[model samples]
Target: MTASYVFSVRFRLSPDAAVSVEPETFETTLYRPADPPGEDGWLFFRDNLWRGEVNDQRHARRLAEDALGVDVEAVEFRRFETDREHYDALKAAIADDLATFNADSVSEVLNKYFGSSVEVVS
Candidate 1:
């Protein structure tokens, strides 16, 4: 079986090397293989996840490298998991985060972690 959800990769870029075309929100499509022992699920993967922002990680890294001259790493990703209820909760969490994200304190923390280039687009 396959499950889809929105994913985000937050990163920073050097001042001298950053892309003029900034991304608002990134999307990722997750594939849940039908198998037992699902408890062994690993959140991080090299590929097989699809995002509307760009292609594979290789492509995303290349874009960052070419445009910003820096390697873009996967800081964190938002996935709802294999359960429908959990997925819905994830969506709600995202929305709540968005609501409180623009606050001064939140921005401060986000800027510290993700830098000023932090952007959210869906």
Candidate 2:
């Protein structure tokens, strides 16, 4: 079976921006296939946090800059395997949001949470 993971990134914005900005954060789900598995890649699911693509570090940085109208000072990414326990907890925590997407599975809920920007790594 493919390995599943949750990916999250935290971004700090430049201080000189015109708009008052808060730290930007995003999360996504990644699916790593076992076959032809040279490097894990993104899974473009319809449902996601930004509702647009935020696949990689560069994309996340760009999104933050664009949304905040400021340069990105730093970005930190955190990833964790979506083992059964973690998945269950996540599902419960986001249960209300998942209902909006009509998601019945963990993958579907993750897709709704992270959209097309989901990344995969081995």
Candidate 3:
């Protein structure tokens, strides 16, 4: 069975030359394969966050476990969403620190990647 949780990332961005000057809200979900213990999962964020590393997801997962003090197998990024474009970019950003998804440091990781744009809803 798949276990899930709510996670979000917040960040600022400059609008296009002709677009509005206000930064748009954006976010996404960091989905992992829940069946297997060590299988890599798909991260849904933005392009700015993607580092083109195959192990990026694994790294983030590890970080989450370290920071949260929770079992790596017990956590997953779930029910993700945003109010702007660049979905892939946001996912990439989260992937940078996938390993740190515990109760302690997951918030920090999200804040680092999304600034104030990330949030966790019950």
Candidate 4:
């Protein structure tokens, strides 16, 4: 099972750039893996998100710029997409790591980190 934070990135393309595009502004998606809970990168939520949203737009754009090798102008979070199995596993892991987060329950952790932006797919 795998999960990823989907973001919509807007970037600028120079006129000298060799591409068959109409506009200078372009949009694309970048997936940041929401590593399995309790894993090394499990703190992604705490580091990058607040209330189910991106905490820093500029930082996110820089990340997109690095990944796309383009000048990113904006970044917007789309969704946290995952499967049922992965979601359940995350819940279980959160329950295990409750103390570190200083939260009372898994639901609280979810709310604080993800809000209502989670999308579970089959």
The candidate scoring highest on lDDT is 4
List candidate 2 segments past 4 Å from native. 1-52, 55-70, 73-86, 95-97, 115-122
Q: All candidates' TM-scores? A: 0.22, 0.28, 0.24, 0.87
lDDT of each: 0.37, 0.43, 0.39, 0.86
Candidate 1: count of backbone clashes, pairs at least 3 residues apart or interchain: 4
RMSD of each: 14.1, 12.6, 16.0, 2.3
- The residue-by-residue lDDT of candidate 3 on 1-122, one tens digit each, is 23322433232345568877442533343443222222344333322232222225555546555654433432333343342332434445445556644323544555544445443333
Q: TM-score order of candidates, best first? A: 4, 2, 3, 1
lDDT tens digits, residues 16-65, model 1?
Answer: 44544345334333322312222234222212232312335665455444
- Give the lDDT of residue 38 in candidate 1: 24
What is the TM-score (0 to 1) of candidate 3?
0.24
Model 4 agreement with the true structure over 1-122: per-residue lDDT tens digits: 88999988889886565655678798888898888877798788778888877899988888888889999998888889999988999999989879977899999988898888899999
Alpha-carbon runs more than 4 Å astray in model 3: 21-35, 38-122
Residue 62 of candidate 3: its Cα lDDT? Answer: 61
Worst 10 residues of 2 by lDDT: 32-41
